[model samples]
Target: MTVLQSFPIPRPTTNPYLIMLGEALRRTPGVTVLNFSWKTALFGRYDVYHSHWPEILVGGRTPLRRLTRQALALMILIRLRLTRRPIVRTVHNVERPDGLTARESALLDVIDRQTTMRIRLNSTTRLPDGERFKTIPHGHYRDWFARYEPQEMQDGQIGYVGLIRRYKGVEGLVSAFRETEGRREGLTLRLGGNPSTSQLAASVASLADGDRRIELHLAYLSDAELVEIVTSSELVVLPYRFMHNSGGALAALSLNRPVLVPDNEVNRKLSDEVGSGWVHLFDGELTAESIITALDAAAVRADRPDLSARDWDRAGIEHADVYRAAIDAGHRR
Candidate 1:
């Protein structure tokens, strides 16, 4: 079966999950991936259309470009319905992205109604009522960064990497770190990734004021640099305001580093799956005590986080099965 993915390979800003999934599908026995393009999406030959984040298709840097993309999105939606092609959307987030224009929201609503199957990264993800879905655990990053030289774990380093968005609560993380007793023990905080806005960067900087131990690499990190930041830390902290599933958390575990995240059913399941001392959870908002307690857990973690359940080969096969099932359902209809 041939599937057209809404992601481009070899794009510098492309997420590693998309890149790895494309490769996995290519390696599968009877599956083919038709890389996305405006020309391909509107006119190309493929069996099923696979969308990861459909919002990007209708967004642009300027109003004129945004309108143009929105027009294209509408055209593509019409073409998909006319051709009777099924769409498989991977549910990365349960909620519709915030800050969508009315037109964009309506377009996505149509896309959602037209969707054939939904792929959830975890079983705990609640779908819209009675939506047909399958749980395909997000794959590990162990194989993707295998070629990079590993960074030695630092004793008292706590690191946060990935896009610096307000919803991610980087400022809260810095504030909590500042209040931690670990600072007297030489515990350091490293912040990487470009901030979503200058104001957000300034806010975090203000929080880190006069603190020499708080290192900031407020820029986009290459794969090697991301690896260095994550692998070098004894503990990784992700203090998101809300998180059901995170590729960042999985990446840290895949690199054999423990993570501290908020306490929730998804995280509790992750902790149970990966084993003790790997996933430290805190109740309510992150605090100084949470950082110190999780850091202590990181200190004595004897074994690597178990990521055997996140194999890419298995993901590829499962994805193929989903595509086949969607096609068969289309035929029956």
Candidate 2:
């Protein structure tokens, strides 16, 4: 009943989903969780190999370099397939395709066809080569919710968390916060999270330079710091330009803090299902003035209980089941 689990460990990045998966595996009898590495994992002996987010491995590299790496990884995966060892891949972000060259895409296509099981967070993701794909909702760190103490509703503090990417709409938040100038009572925007790129950092800093109220921590945040920021904030807003599923939104809800997100089809579905009125639906007209108006309104209704107790526990258990199903299916084949 021994199982080998391999997942990427990115530095200065705390993947709560990966950590939760490892914890779930540890709880299961006769499962061995192994750290994922290129050279080691390819050669390691195991009953089952579960890889997370194959898209990321193909992304963020130069075209030539990405092609080369994909070829190498594909070769290893092909060899593993020939051995008939069960391999399962979990697709974390199916909302966006990996920036891959034609060759890399074809290579991944091959692997996807051969892989025994494909796990996805959302049920809507299409399977590659008509392979077996299962739906698994992402999990949150259970301890993150325990550390939160609801702060007194103060007038000026707003919090935003998650990887500070341009698409995340941090600039929109900054613009909206600026519009609140002189109109609201001491409005301050406290941004805490990892910035994916230097361009994003510079962009945020440039906006925050003159404004003392806008405090941006352009560094990797620990779990404790995350708890502190989320719990202390008056309201948490996820002003994403386009978001598939927000880990930030779930984290905020786990802390009993309300979240304000754009009213997209995906977000609206999640908000409605969770019964959390915390979501602020913004149509295509998200100007600085419009956003400020929304923020002002949210300040008053921030304490409204939007999320139901059912949605929270259901998300966690669904994730646990995905892991178990992957393992069980491996044994079956």
Candidate 3:
């Protein structure tokens, strides 16, 4: 059987899910994983059509192109349905980060009604309730990121690394860092990553201006730069207003570095399940006082969560089982 994944295949990516899952899927017998595109999907030759982040399937700038992609998606759906193939969806986010348009909303409606199998990367994901939902934990970045010997932390350097977004509480982190600088001594806050927009970058830049206590690398960081940013930190702070899952937190843990995350079920669970005094928590209002308290409470540990539970080989077997079941479901239909 063949499965077409709705993500860039055979392409180098920092995303651990693709790197690890792709590695494992390649090893799975009788399963062919192919790169997906509207053109390739038009051929209608796959047993299973799997997609993560459905928005990407219909991503476009012009309304005409968007509509065209939507029509293509419908055609693919129709072909799959008529061929009795399984259509699987992985709900990576509760809603699109950039919100949705009328066409995007309609696309999701059809997909929700037609999808034969749904994989929830997190059980608490905000997708609509359905019997089609299948819970699967996200794969870890430990292997792909190449676990390296952690260097000694210098001057309580706290860091945040990943795509800088508006809702990610970058502003709040900056404010808290400034407040911390006022109270704490000899500490620096380093933020590295390309911002969501040049405007947002400018806003953050203005806020960070004249502050020697904070350092910003507002660009797409290379692997070596990412390593330095993560390993040199005493603690990695991800003060997201909310979250479903975070590869950033997992990456920090893989490096045996403690992480301070917002107090939510997903983050708290990561702390409880895979912690060696590394996960620190802060509740609503990530104020400087609260941030300092969590930072002070955090302690470096020799032990960390063994991320082997997220290995792709085991996940691949489970995925294969799901595919076989989906294929059977198709046969029944």
Candidate 4:
């Protein structure tokens, strides 16, 4: 069984989740893995198509590029339907991406309708009516970063790393850290990752201005740099306005560091899965008190988060099972 992945294999800048999943799928018994390209997507031979971040297919930097990709996306959808190929889409985001054009939305609707199965990275994900789905915990990054030399963990160092976007609430994090008082003399906030826009970059910069305790690396972070950010921090805070399944949180845990995230059902469930004192949460809006409180909580935890459920080998087997089932059902349909 050949499974076509929507993303390419591991690269210096590839998302670690995709790289790990791709490697695991390749090792799975009776399964062959193929990385996606426009050519392979439209005309390649594969038994099951597994798509992650399908929106990327229709997104582009400019209007002309977007239009071209949207056309190809339409053609791909038509071919999949005509050939009766099954699509296994990973539900990475809870909703249709914000700021999508109407045509992109319609094309995504087609992809949703044609999907045979959806993979949820966490058990707490809620799908629309009548959508068939499976829960495959996003794999940990312990093995992925094993090659890098571990950075010495620093006390009172809180870090946030990954692509910085407005919805991620980086500015809020900076504000909270700035206002936090008492026992924070040793606390330093580290922010890393490229911003989505110049305005966002400036917003975070303005908030972080004159705060020597706050460090910003507003550029694409390589794997080694990411490892240093995660490993060195006593706690990693991801104050996203909306966070369902975060690779950042998992990466922090994989590196044996605790994390502070938004309080929600998904995060609550994650806390239970990982263990006590490993995943702390802040409710409502992120504030100075929440940041300080979560930091205090992370300081006392000495045990590692339990990530046995997220082993890449297990993820590979589970993905292969889903792919096989989707293929069988596709044939029947």
Highest lDDT scorer:
1
What is the C-alpha lDDT profile of model 1 across 203-244, one tens digit per residue?
988999988889999989998998999989988999998889
lDDT tens digits, residues 161-267, model 4?
99999889998999988987574678898899999999999999999999889899999998899999988998899999999889999988989899899999999
Per-residue alpha-carbon lDDT of candidate 3 for residues 198-263, written as tens digits (9 for 90 to 100): 999999898999999899999988766777898888788888988777888887887767888888
- Model 4 lDDT at residue 181: 51
Q: Which is the winner by TM-score between candidate 3 and candidate 4? A: 4
Instruction: Report the lDDT tens digits of candidate 2 across residue range 1-333.
Output: 334555655344657766666666666554556667677556776666676666655554576877667766776677666666666777766644645567657766766665677777665566667576767666644454565554555555788877788778888788778867777766678898778888888888887778888888888787777777877776687888877767888787677666777776667666665554455667663455554555566554444444453243454454445556655665565
- In candidate 1, which residue ranges exceed 4 Å CA deviation? 181-184
Clashes of 3: 0
Return the TM-score for candidate 4, rounded to 2 decimals: 0.95
Each prediction's TM-score versus the true structure: 0.96, 0.79, 0.93, 0.95
Which pairs clash (backbone N, Cα, C closer than 3 Å) in model 2? 276-306
Q: lDDT score, residue 106, model 1?
A: 85
Candidate 3 lDDT score at position 125: 73
Candidate 1 accuracy as lDDT: 0.90
Error of 4 at 9 (Å): 4.4
lDDT of 1 at 53: 92
Better of 1 and 4 by lDDT: 1
